[model samples]
Target: MYKYDEIDQTLVDERVAQFRGQVTRRLSGALSEDEFKPLRLQNGLYLQLHAYMLRVAVPYGVLSSRQLRGLSQIACKYDRGRGHFTTRQNIQFNWIKLEEAADALADLAKVQMHAIQTSGNTIRNTTTDQFAGAAHDEIEDPRLWCEIIRQWSTFHPEFSFLPRKFKIAVTGSPNDRAAVRVHDIGLRMHKNAAGEVGFEVIVGGGLGRTPFIGKTIRDFLPKQDLLSYLEAILRVYNEFGRRDNLYKARIKILVHEIGIETMREKVEAEWLTSRDGALKLPQAAIDQIAAHFAPPAFEALPGGIAREYAEAFRTDFEFGLWARRNTAKHKQPGYSIVTVSLKKEGAAPGDASAEQMAAVADIADRYSFGEVRVTHEQNLVLPHVRQADLPAVYAALKAYDLATPNVGLVSDIIACPGLDYCALANARSIPVAQQIALRFRNWERAHDIGELKIKISGCINACGHHHVGHIGILGVDKNGEEFYQLTLGGSADENAALGDILGPALNATDAVDAIDTLVETYLRIRQAGERFLDTYRRTGLAPFKEAVYAAA
Candidate 1:
């Protein structure tokens, strides 16, 4: 909810104009595809399987109703009549034309949105907890710092171009909703002993061809030094991160090669020279940016909201399960975080049709103070909904085919648009994801299955974040055919750990059964009421792994 200032608008406008000119030159053949590739990529434009895909950044995943409506317009006007919300809290239009890319960007700028940091080797969209200002356990609103970081990193002259892409995730809550531990630079905010707010900074975490849980370089950095500390880290990465080998060029590899001790020392030395310089965070500036995230003037609702919500749930078992999963604890007494599931039985994961988009807008207008968020989980969030309104919201959403009620269940699959759509994909992911969802369509059965994060990716690029799922399914090529590989025991919590491969790959037809075997084995062996992840940790993947590969 960081309001744009004149400076912010001007910067966005300039970037759009610059990219527009670049697109013009590229289309005119003055700049060849080879030459224009990097430039266009820097602006978040990519030529996909069918057409150009334009990724539009939704900073910190926050979107006003107006902005969401704008995105709906872009999808209808420039590309397909729909858009794909990505795990990074942004949306990708998969059918944009090369010539229409600039116009798409221009339209985005009109709504205080752009694809500025949606790609390229720079600090990408600063994601935070989807329930940033509303989460009960949060120390402070993290989006304030995210917005500050966005401003600092936008076209930062010294760090604009780097050996590899840089990603930063911030979390104010103890819960790791943004998967901070799996980012290039992760910031966790907490109150220090002296009642001062500071960050526990981690570096080197990322998910792709090589997944790494970033190591903590500094346990606690004072808030005022946020920008300086980040600048120093980027400087060390820019100078020492691998450049010769693209495969090993990520900061994680650099951290791994140099050792955490050496990386920490280097970052500290860089910080010693850079802290309090131009990048140092000022109290006034921080306060000014922080002001935009001030909590909405929430009216006092009746305390019976919880009772009313439960009554509806009691009457509806499916709605009851959804309330338990999709809704999160809100900071206020009666408010709740409502996740609008895009994964209906047959729709592609993370997709919102033009009509569904407008439905979300309408829901936001009626219940959520005209604000919504695109979570890294690829679901729309009404973060500050009143508990009393849960039934009505659920009803409205159900009418729009947005009410899946399988938030943390196995059917809530995360997948990238793979071979069927993306040019870079090696295999199909969406169909596989759909198959899994269909396999779990029995709400009662899915509800019994319990909490699990199933992430899928078409190829190693990991656009779908397959590396972080409790049950990770990665699509790969086998003799010009598709094969699905499974990984179990991954998590993105405070104790964030990447999942491990469970063994050999399975053909597309065999995958759903394989997953069912794993889940059934988990249910059989797991302690009473234990979650899938918890059971996996306590008993190890041996049980599920053995069962999955047993008679195959």
Candidate 2:
């Protein structure tokens, strides 16, 4: 919802031009792969297993209908008729010509989009809760702050080339839908006793080969000093942070090695000097950004227990399932946030077909006032849908294969495009994810199984957030065949915790069965009303592991 001003447009144009030159140099052999790898990576171009993959950033997963339509065009023209939305709230064209990346970036700029900072060891996309503005219990729309951070960090002079990439997540919701606690910098909005709004800043959380839950650096930071405070923290990391080894280079490592208390001391020392500097935010600027996210003049919709709504659920079992899964609480009394799950049966997760994209845009236009959000969970959000029109919306989505009701269920998996598309990947991820989804196709079974986040990344980079999945699966290639190693009890939520590995790797073909075994075993063993994570936390891995491996 943040509109690009002339300055923003100029920045995009200039970056595109810069990348054009860089790409030209690479193509002309003036810049070898050694020189061009970082340059191309910075521009969001990667040479994968088969072809070039171009990742375009959709900041905080927000997109206009026009932008979505443009992406559909890009998918149809440059890619294989679909673009894969990433866990970082970005879209990737798995098949792209190396020569056309600059042109592709230009096309993106036309719609006020770009791929800058999507990759490389700089700050990546700042993600927020999908239902930011429309969520019922938000302190404020977090995307406003996300946009402010975007402007402040974009191509920053000092922090541009860091030891490792950084990620920041914010959520206005108290429930922590954005998984802020697992980010490099996690910001949760809250109000003090005096009713003045502020942020709870947490730092050092990340998921990779090493995963950590961020520790609270500040109990409460006034909204006005957000940028300056953030600057102080970044300055501490930039100046004193480790850079000797890439693996030990993130701020999380710094926080762990230096100890949270010492790190806090260093950050406070820096903040004392930088608090009133130019980075200190202006009240007018914050208000200006907030204006863009103003809620629509939503008239009170009929909240009665309408027979039509009830009948739709009662008669159509599929509609019932979808409504149960795809809808979230809305700020307005009778409105709901309708999540359009991109992960349907047997297809790629987060990869929406052109037709599906258009249909979603149509739904946004007709029912939700032409605003749709691409969520980090690889789904689309019609942020404000009337409770009465749920049936009609469900009917419309049913036609496009977007009506899958497996949100937060086993089938709603997050997976990266692996060896199938990515050269860096050691094992194929999409097919394995599809197999797991197909295996758990039974609606009753998945619902009974309850919430599970199964993320699969092909390699150790953890692009799919495999480190954070309730049942994290990491694919590895042993010799020529693929195998998967599983990690359990991981969660990305209000109680964020990285999973621990259960045991040895499973054969590639047996991976889905392995996942199915784990879920079924949990169902049989869990206490009443306990979810997968809760059971894992309570009972530990021995029972599930015994049940799973005992059969073998």
Candidate 3:
């Protein structure tokens, strides 16, 4: 985890002080709601349907036990008693009072965290794989680059107010867990023919009204020129991206309209001018940042499954199931990555109570070197848990309802707050997700289904990343009634592709049943060892569509 320096501390403190005054003015009638809108948004505060929502950034999804404790305190003291972890790996408090917003931020600053650039057209949190430092197959830890980008873009005057919000994601592993291809700028780390690692810079990828799997603008970008290349892309978008229509404002829209070839030409022209400038990262500077993220000290433990882990797997059937679904291989010997599933049956996805958060903090401190990670899938992670302690970690997590062994299963659905919380939402998403998750409560059936990512969004904003889900559901407003439109064959991996929609929007109840029907159809027709996504890609939408609509 990267700790804040003097500069980082000062900037966060100043922002807190600045926003505190802004809030005071708004309360004093010196600033009206409309006047304070942008000011508050710049500080990551939003006025939702019923209350104010505060989004706190968790850069690259890394958090210390101390920081987690700070967030837990803020959740309990300032807002509601829970925090919602977002798809971007940030956390949100749904019920914040305007007067207390500043105090909450002040508290966050004490822990070297803040909500800066979390909203309002700025480069929002630069995310990466949750297992960045710990993944065994990583070419290099992407968090090192993510942090560099964060330092460069924090207050860059040129990109402070782009035509629309921007997002960037990085993945160092061949298996893209960060969903890099669905970002405005996706940087994939891989080795070249010379056996040197560099980034594959993909541009114009995004999800919303118009979803796209970003095009590869540069096949291999050297690590040294990262900042210069990013500057070129932003400059091109800032100058040429639409400002006339809000709907057409994103860089993706500009790429769609002008074509990626032209977009590339403009960016390349811009890069030529900036490549050798101060923005070019030198080896010394890179090393300075890299030093901050060096791997944690590890004991000289032997490799392979620990004796305790094997014994538990043999004797405890429930433990065996949980271990298989929730744990992942780590880079270090005898250590495993534990994903704490937030999507328990019938509960809202990605939400954790203050108590639950504190419990995780304690668990991390005791067994995982006090470090935790928030995943893009909206789950918490104990990134360095020893394999010997798997049972203990499972027991601790199970006590708080966090041990829902469904990491990539049907019940582990990703969904936005939807009509339940978001003001822009036209239909309810939480209830729909809950209903669908409940239908897949059978552990045998869910495990059998295998690696189905069901993402739901209240609207086309794609906050829940519906466009990249294996089975995507989008809520729609139809004559004041809530309905859902389904899309299948979508995935957010290395071979990322936008989902194809199944015909027609179904009412909420019908939509839930349709998912069951779709799964049943896949199970019936799929060849041996085929997952839902594999079956969909093999058979296309015809079979699943026929099964769903025919049942309706």
Q: What range of 10 consecutive residues in model 2 has the weakest lDDT sum? A: 300-309
Which scores higher on TM-score, 2 or 3? 3
Q: How well is each residue in 164-190 modelled by candidate 1, as lDDT tens digits?
A: 888899999888888999999999998
TM-score of each: 0.97, 0.97, 0.99
Q: 1 or 3: which has the higher TM-score? A: 3
Top lDDT hit: 3
- How many clashes show up per model? 1, 1, 0
lDDT value for candidate 3?
Answer: 0.94
Q: Predictions ranked by TM-score, top down?
A: 3, 1, 2
Give the residue spans of candidate 2 off by over 4 A.
none
lDDT of 1 at 79: 70
Q: CA shift at 158, candidate 2, in angstroms?
A: 1.4
After best superposition, candidate 3 residue 452: deviation in angstroms? 0.6
Q: List model 3 lDDT by residue over 459-534, tens digit each.
A: 9999989988899999999999999999998999999999998999999999999999999999999999999888
Candidate 2 residues 27-89, lDDT tens each?
A: 898999999998889888888878888989989988888888888888887777888888888
